[model samples]
Target: MLINLSGVDKDNYTLSILKSLEKHNSGSLKITVVMGKTAPHINSIRQFAKTAPFECQVLVNANNMAELMAQSDWAIGAAGSTSWERCCLGLPTLLLVIANNQRTIAEQLQQVGAAISLHVQEIDTPKFTECVAFFRQPENLAQMSEKVVRLCDALGAKRVAQHIEDLTKNEDFANIRRATLDDCRQVFEWRNHADIRQFMFNTDELIWENHAAWFAKQLGNPDFIMLIYQVNGVAQGYVSFTRQSENIWEWGFYLAPTCSRGQGSRMGRLALAWAFAELGAAKIIGQVLPHNIASLKLHEKLGFFRLPEKNDVAQFELSLDKCYIKKQFHSRFKIE
Candidate 1:
């Protein structure tokens, strides 16, 4: 866990967090705290670090917030710009609203189940400790992280770039990255969603045991690429490519149920571009349910041609040479 107190010189919130940690120490949770860049309360954090039994770090002007935050499973951060950064990484936070201006951001995130907002006036050991303890549950922890991604996608920057080639700057989407074991729980949530599962070739709610086993194999499989899409550093959707042959890949994707409509089209475009540009695929194919009209249209919009049904599945194919990516839909990578 990484606890960031932002730029506040002397915050009572840090003390509250430390006290909470002291009580939870026996549980074996390691913690690292960043006491503001120009913290005047450094003495307290440093002193606590020395006497604490659990692994604890007290950093000032802590190194790359993104990298540090990404490495952490949970954060107790001052509610501010870093809230968005947390959202991007899908790192659930117990946000301390230190300033009056921060309530709206904190509240909005809380409303979306992305975070828990606590007024600095109420900052104390007991309440903070309770929240941390609740998160210790595997189901609660996984759900909170999953909710964070729904509200802010870490891939927003790239998704926005896919629409505007000449734009110089934007924070609309987050960078897309390969999936790992840590993401299995979240992927399971997306996959098990009734809406998402219904359109699959096999429409069954996967049990955790089976899903975990399948997901583990996919992560290390060279023939499969599972990418998590983030908007503003929070995960919003999933895209994957499975190798069918030497020059062809089968692709599929789905947006979080809370995601907006037009974005699905954008994701398809981005995934297709990645298949051609990154993987150097000669062609890409999709298996669509005949009743799944939305996917059928999406494939056509992205230049996929209809083919005869294969084993009761509506088949679509896009040959690299004939693909016609939408004008507003651009690839994240440059087209040389």
Candidate 2:
């Protein structure tokens, strides 16, 4: 579990939660506490850590809040900006209304079943333990995670920037180009990343020698097209297509491991546009593992229709006409 008490009075709120946490058996439960740089009660928390039942790590002004939250199953924190960040990552949380301004944010999230909300005054051993037990069930956590992710996509900043660039520069903020030899190593690392490999049809780890040889062959082949998607000249993701026929292509894509959540959607839109408009693809085909929910949702959102499964693999296809319809909806962004 993760606990972040940055804006609230740490003296009152921190101790209350700690007292409740002490009641639960540590077992495999680990506690991570994140605080602001100048926040008080640092010594108090450190003192408790020495004798706490659970394994605890206290971070002062850590820069990797999102990373930490992503690793945690659930969180207990104030209903502030980080609430949306947790929602974007689908981390179910118990939110406390630390101030009058936070009341509405907490209440609405609770109403939507995205989070459990309570005033700081309501913190107690029984309440905290109850919430923890509720989240311990896999089905309960999954349902809450589904609801929370719909609240925010974690792309508000990117969307705003795209609009600003459209109004001012009137030039494309993102572009795609054919991959080069220089990109071989970066693409290899991204493809081999644990997160990306888990969803692949072949989950076996790839050796460098085999990957290098295969990449070299793909680079030289005319029928196999590899494109790197970039924003402001920085490579964000890669998409590849192999011509199966004169007008049909099989494709796959993966974003850089560090890229934000919604970037895959942006990359997909650009890729589909390129396949249909530039490459003259009449139809684009993709295969996704049944467990890769994110990719399945992304394919559907990009206008791909499901085809009959073959060999337990989920298949999808998009026609040029469908691509054109999707383009009309997102005409604000240049597809090239």
Candidate maximizing TM-score: 2
Identify the runs in model 1 with alpha carbons over 4 angstroms from their true place.
Answer: 1-171, 324-336
Instruction: Assess each prediction's global lDDT (C-alpha) against the native.
Output: 0.79, 0.84
lDDT for position 108 in model 2: 91
Candidate 1 Cα deviation (angstroms), residue 304: 0.3
Candidate 1 residue lDDT tens string, 1-336: 888877664645686677766776534777878766567778877887888877888778766788888888888887898898888888988888888899999999999888888877665556766787776677876898999977777777888787665564553664456777988998899888998998887888889999999999988898999987776667788989999999899998888878876877767777777667678888999998888999999998888889999888899999887865523334452322
Instruction: Tell me how far the alpha carbon of residue 297 in candidate 2 is from the true structure, in angstroms, after superposition.
Output: 0.2
Model 1 lowest lDDT segment of ten: 327-336
RMSD of each: 20.8, 21.5
- Number of the top candidate by lDDT? 2
